[model samples]
Target: MNGRLIAIGDIHGCHQEFADLLQLIKLEPGDQLILLGDLVNRGPDSHRVVELARQHGAIALLGNHERRLLAARRNPDKVKVRDSEKATYSQLDDADWAYLNAMPLTHEVPELNMVFVHGGFLPDRSWREQGADIVTEVQVIDRDGRPCKRREAPEALPWADHWTGPPFVVYGHTPRDDVYKLKWSLCLDTACAMGGQLTAFILPERRLVQVKARRRYYP
Candidate 1:
């Protein structure tokens, strides 16, 4: 509370980049870290990312990818595995699986005027009013139940464009070429899961930090 507050982007199991970003950040005493989620999967080291994030006392959010992993874990036969995520899923232990299942979908510090979520927040609703569908798979949704390009889409008024905020929402889920610093929020998912840079935003200082991926981990 007395130190800098940092929000990290989607990791997608790029543990080395995650570690490098942490080293680059050089965590100071009292500084707090908020992992914007999707901390696992798609890359090679979901195990280590979760370990490091927890070891450093970072606050992790539940991401869409994590949501999928949780559902699969709960009822293993009810899911199909994708190549990019199979290795990550195979490596996670019971505790790791539970961690993903138990993570909160969103986090906010109103006093800091900040919110942390895995996906986009609906502009028309309050954080508490939002459901997983809105927070886990949002982009350019015309209605609460409407669909967006869950992977990538250029249409539908990007979520940040509609963000009206006091507690500025900081989120991941969409992998972008760059971060979105809108009038009301920040989109920090600089495509870390897709072989892009792993990014983080330092609060109060309002500084952005990143580390390039060691290699492309997924398609």
Candidate 2:
């Protein structure tokens, strides 16, 4: 029983929607599930979402939210955010934080000539080059209204149609009202946490499937 290859967008803690989307796709035990990243934060049940991914043997990538959680854990004084965002971080336990930190930033499947990244990849660079070492530099807006750069690839490598590295690059982070499918990349983040739907792509077939959340799962 050969299973299909399914890649999901950022879940953002929308557990119910994620579960429903899986059922809609009829994900079987043999199926391979890959998550593009942002599995936690901004939505309800971030912990549950991560656990679900683990239970199903899914390959979950790291996203910016996860990095934020790590930063908050490391330097609580450095953490400054809205009440909602702060609460989300406060909910994370040591074990949950470890899980998020342990996730890989990108995953490559040579057979499909596809790479899964959380945001997008930098233009004109291979995934290997972009994700060479574990530590990465990420750009973020700081409290001083200045652009602060942090270590950790916050999102997928920025990509465009000019890319020729691989046939397909699946990623999340920037959720579109509609899934954006370009010749070389696919943006599956539906912003489920923001009252959108949870989306998944069936590889090889390039079929898109989604399940709308019952409510806004995130702030």
Candidate 3:
């Protein structure tokens, strides 16, 4: 297979698994690796995951988990705290928070007509405006689940299927048993931290490559 645009799913701080997957993919310096975010939290070595991605110049988006981590680090009382054997609230440093906050929520590669986001895209809105407008309007649920209105389907979100722009949106918030391709979107998150496989989709060719975790890496 020729080298192409490779987008990985939600990492959730499984540094070992993430590193193993990188080795499995045989990543070259020329290959572009797009990470779909949730890089930290719920797993071990969240700091390492961020650093590795940074060192490799990987394209990473800011997922909800990262948002929560930033929020917690900024103001711990606002969000409910959880205990885990892996890295937790007390473990993150100032640089970690800076790195998380510096990440963009969405990244668009107009040349390839591909857009990368931590979650799905809003078809009705531009990616630039997504954070300021939509994210704040929606009420955030617990870290473990999707944010939704009371009694609404978890998959249901404002403009969940609205993208009609040039670049096809590729995201990773909702994990699936397999890669999910919609009319204008693709979901690559296979929940690697939950003992599931981490997936990557090659754009245009739409080929799928995945690395399954050997065990539950997250607490």
- Looking at model 3, residue 146 earns an lDDT score of 45
Worst 10 residues of 3 by lDDT: 132-141
Where's the lowest-lDDT run of ten residues in candidate 1?
A: 143-152
Q: Report, for all candidates in order, the number of backbone clashes.
A: 0, 10, 2
The Cα RMSD of model 3 versus the native structure comes to 4.7
Every model's TM-score: 0.92, 0.80, 0.79
Per-residue alpha-carbon lDDT of model 1 for 1-219, expressed as tens digits?
Answer: 799998999998888898888889998879898998888877878999998877778889988888887777667787866676788888988767767777898897878777888887766767788888778888766544354864444446777777788778888887888898888888898887677898989988889998988887777
Each model's lDDT comes to: 0.82, 0.73, 0.70
The lDDT ranking, best first, is 1, 2, 3
What would the C-alpha RMSD of candidate 2 be, to one decimal place?
5.5
- Model 1 misplaced regions, further than 4 Å: 143-147, 150-154
The model with the greater lDDT, 1 or 3, is: 1
- Report the C-alpha lDDT of model 3 over 1-219, residue by residue, as the tens digit: 245668898888788888888887777867778888888777677888888888788877777777776666678678655565225566666766677788876777777777787766444455676672344223223233444432455545433344565677777777667777767777787878888988878665777888887788754
Candidate 1 RMSD to the real structure? 2.0
Clashes by residue pair, model 2? 119-155, 119-156, 120-156, 120-157, 121-156, 121-157, 121-158, 122-157, 122-158, 136-152
